[model samples]
Target: MIICHCQSISDQDIRAAVDWMRAADADTIITPGKVYHALGKRADCGGCMPLFLDTMRQCDSFGVATAAERPPILRPARLRLAQAR
Candidate 1:
């Protein structure tokens, strides 16, 4: 269950962080760095990245919703620029 040994981060911790971040800002993109920051920890060794990412993916709130799922106003700048062109 421990995803990052260096940071003493567990799968549950990752999930909780992800959930909290999503709740705080629904449109914010969740990343490993953000998760670490949310947990008040930082990555030491780079080895845990693979497992860390896997754990993040398993979290329900980990993935950002696709353009179709998000409101038009919330779409990324690139998408809006493409549309404008």
Candidate 2:
């Protein structure tokens, strides 16, 4: 279950970090770097990146917010005027 061999990170560690982050800030975006920082570690070799990303993707709160979930996009005044005309 070790995701990062260099940093000695486990699947449990990843899950714990993710849960803690989500609890701290629901809107906060979780990434491998943040997870590593949360665990008081950092990525060493670039090799573990793929597995690291896979483990992160396994987490429930790992995806970006959908358009409907995000705030409405606003158009620039010039663009709006052009469209209106």
Candidate 3:
């Protein structure tokens, strides 16, 4: 499934790039521009953004690398702890 027609980027390519980026730097922020840079291309137009974002979120390793990286306040337990303090 092609995600970005301008860059000739496919869903698989995006997945691979996402996995590679995650593996390379667990804390690194992944974005469409970064993916395009990784693939040696660029976004020609804003048309593919919706599908592009969907494919990116579908990736398994598509989130923060560790529990600490996630927003602590977002967790109920942590929220309670913060309130306690």
Candidate 4:
């Protein structure tokens, strides 16, 4: 279940990274670059992007948070402005 042949990243690696990221910051947006950084690797080719994203989404905490769930920092600027006012 290797997701990225170029980086030698497996599905398990992706999942572990995702889970760790979720645990570290529930409000953080998980991306391929972040995953690569987490695993101490770099993206060498663009071919694995689609599959990489798929594997990331498979994780339980891999989507945009609802309005209520979103951290204040992640809220839309307009929403923040309204709240501030």
* Highest lDDT scorer: 4
lDDT of 4 at 13: 97
In model 1, the runs with Cα more than 4 Å from the true position are 64-85
Q: TM-scores across all candidates?
A: 0.74, 0.72, 0.76, 0.74
Q: Report the error of model 1 at residue 81, Å.
A: 14
Q: Give me the runs in candidate 4 sitting further than 4 Å from their true place.
A: 64-85
**Model 3 ranges with Cα > 4 A deviation:** 65-85
Model 3 Cα RMSD, 1 decimal: 4.3
lDDT of 3 by residue, 1-83 (tens): 98888889999999999999999998777898999999998899979999999999899998854555566654468655765
Best by TM-score: 3
Clashes of each: 0, 0, 0, 0
Residue 5 displacement in candidate 2 (angstroms): 0.7
Q: Residue by residue across 1-85, what tens digits does model 2's lDDT show? A: 8888888999889988988898899878787889999999988977988988888878876655343343233445555566568
lDDT of 1 by residue, 27-78 (tens): 7878899999999998898899999998888888876447746555778888
- lDDT tens string, model 4, 1-82? 9999998999999999999998899767888999999999999978999999999988877766465356778788888788
Give each model's whole-structure lDDT. 0.85, 0.79, 0.86, 0.88
Error of 2 at 59 (Å): 1.0
